[model samples]
Target: MRRDELEGAVREALSHQVAVARPLSADPAGQAIRRAKRIRRRRTGAGLALAAVATVLVSTGMAQLGGDPGRQGKPVVVIGDPNPSGRPIPSATVTAAAPTSETPVDVLAGATLIGVSGGRLELPGVGPAERAHLLPSGGWLVVGAPTTAGRSLWVAQHDGLVQVLLAGAGSIVVAPDGRQVAWRDGTGLLVAGVVGTQLIGPVRTPVPGKAEPVRFIGDNVLVRLDPDGPGHTLWRPGVGELTAGSDRSTLNVYGALPDGRLVGQVSTDDPAKTCLAVLDPKRDLKPVLTGCGPELSPDGAGAVSGDGRWLLVNGWVGKTSGSLLVDLRRLGQDLTAVPAGPPVSGEVAWRTESEATYVDGAGKLVQVNVDQVRTGKVAEPVSVPGVRPGDRPVLVTG
Candidate 1:
């Protein structure tokens, strides 16, 4: 909708609404006549003005539903259950996401958003679109709508003299710590990420002569199942192929366990089989757990499995697809569940374990609690303006 039309809608809605006014009759006859006239006149004028304001708001979808501008610009997108365990989330005046940092940027729950900062990015395949939120980490996030293209794919703009990613971005990531990002682009994988503005370089994960899927381990590293070589090649940032697995076909590199130990599996379908094992370049592979996949924390301090425990087969529904969270305290265990929502491809945000938030099935903002995890009761969804999507939701974690 155009800006003017939004203004008109707001005006129309406010025009006929009643206002809190002092009792009209509690006055002397002469004064009452004057007061009544003044009230009517004021109401008429106010109504018209409000209508104008409403029109602006509705057309542009810029609804300042709460606090001032500063608070409205809270930069972070998280997908998970709402922490209904206790305190209320701070009221925010959310806005549509934009290319710049100051503007009120918004994205639909289903849509993914990528922002790049620090420098410019050059995509050989596509051109940059309109102004959207870009991070300062020298990485640009591209919102790839989940179609065949993949759900809301985020890519770092180009960087370096011969840039590979996040180069078109304006803002840079303040602190990436040591995180690696990857996604499937057809058969090969594009891996480029950061540790707070530090470019981790991108690779066209070698698939030997016959291409296969590529997986990210951590840092600026990736594991490619060398078609020619015997097993998986453990690739690291700037230091290619640190180690290779014994059996080339089975080794699938997931990533480094926070303890600096590598974890992975031999892709399989049998539930009775253990899928997880330690891939230390030093020692031989050892079985640790199964029925769960390896995942690391945002800070790179830990790893988790989506399912803390193996599913009991007798009554178990088909294995859950979203993910399994493993308990760090126990070696061969996993978390019950991490809340089964669609996998949003872009930046994901999560505050605590129990309280999680994500854009729901209908593209409305949903806050889920542990109760929702047990019963699958999603909380009332909230809407952020300018964000428009119906299939997937993205958490903007800047």
Candidate 2:
């Protein structure tokens, strides 16, 4: 009942309250600050969005998140990339979900530009890519959207580190070995060595007419000049000289075979038709083989297999817009054709010597097997999850 007794009772009550009470959050202010930082980071990276409509892969019943369907994976951010904005580079590998029963069928192919993880397209950190070339080092040199100068060129490493290589760049090509890259940046054609992800010892040479490097064959680069004509040249990087072939005026070279022979479309008697011709460069570029493949597309939308044994071209197959597969081994033999559902966009990519893929009009990725087509069968179309029709023309490397 004394004053000291009353004080002791009050202190005991205060101790009990402190022991039982809890803070609203472990660190409410710190949490709020972290949330604000994340939002700002997203806003800063908004300009890097390549698609008009952002896409996210939704895991089907095959893969479940916390017992429910969910987005595939988190965005991977790599720091200290060459980006001036200091934005984290989103690694393509991170967005891949584990394979599911609904996963698209994958075929053996050359290295793809973007990671097709789990049979789905893992959109890279680069802009809307118009074309991509695979680097021998397991990376990609991506050609992005058009700008005032030209298209933007970016290098995406295998690790998903994206760096803007050059802006306003014209047609670009990576050497067969992936050791070098050449591009026309309006001023002239430039060839640069590629080490890891960096450009080294860039050498420039002025080229006349509208020149675009097409392919790399041995030590020479095949260049096409004036898209409308049969003007082509072979140039050696850093040599500063363009060599015109004896057949340069007549042959519209598409690409070279593994044996260094040139494959191109030669004029036929009918104005509407052209022969899928092969020119032996060793023999003064003379046409050794001349026979039009089945319905070779007028625009020549096709590609040759690495071995040069097969040729695939886009054309009509019984009134259906499709791709024709020809056996170069037996040029006069029966031709194999596969219908292209929707309209075929972008060029076809050889997944392997016998398998190839292309994005159709519907933004769906479709694969074709040479063996299956030879048997009079067609491969099924695989829908690229999360991709809408408008997200095309999706650039998958050839």
Local accuracy by lDDT, each model: 0.33, 0.54
Residue range 134-178, candidate 2, lDDT tens digits: 555545566666655466666654333556555555677767566
Q: Can you write out model 1's per-residue Cα lDDT over 1-398, one digit (the tens) per residue?
A: 46686555446534432222223221112222222232221111111122122111222123431232322122111111111112121111112324343211223233223221211112322222221223443333443332321233233322211112222121122222324444333333334443322223344343233333344334434444453332555445455533444544334444445565555554445434334455564343333444343432111111222222221111112453232333334444652334334322233233244444444335455444544545765245555433334324344433
What's the TM-score of each model vs. the native? 0.40, 0.67
Error of 2 at 385 (Å): 1.5
Evaluate model 2: give its lDDT.
0.54
| Ten residues in sequence with the least summed lDDT for candidate 2 | 56-65
- Runs in model 2 deviating more than 4 A are 1-93, 96-98, 101-114, 119-125, 248-254, 282-284, 332-344, 393-398
For model 2, give the RMSD to the true fold: 19.1
**Where does candidate 2 clash, by residue pair?**
108-351, 109-351, 109-352, 110-351, 343-361
Model 1 scores a C-alpha lDDT of 0.33
Instruction: Return the TM-score for candidate 2, rounded to 2 decimals.
Output: 0.67
- In candidate 2 the C-alpha lDDT for residue 124 amounts to 44
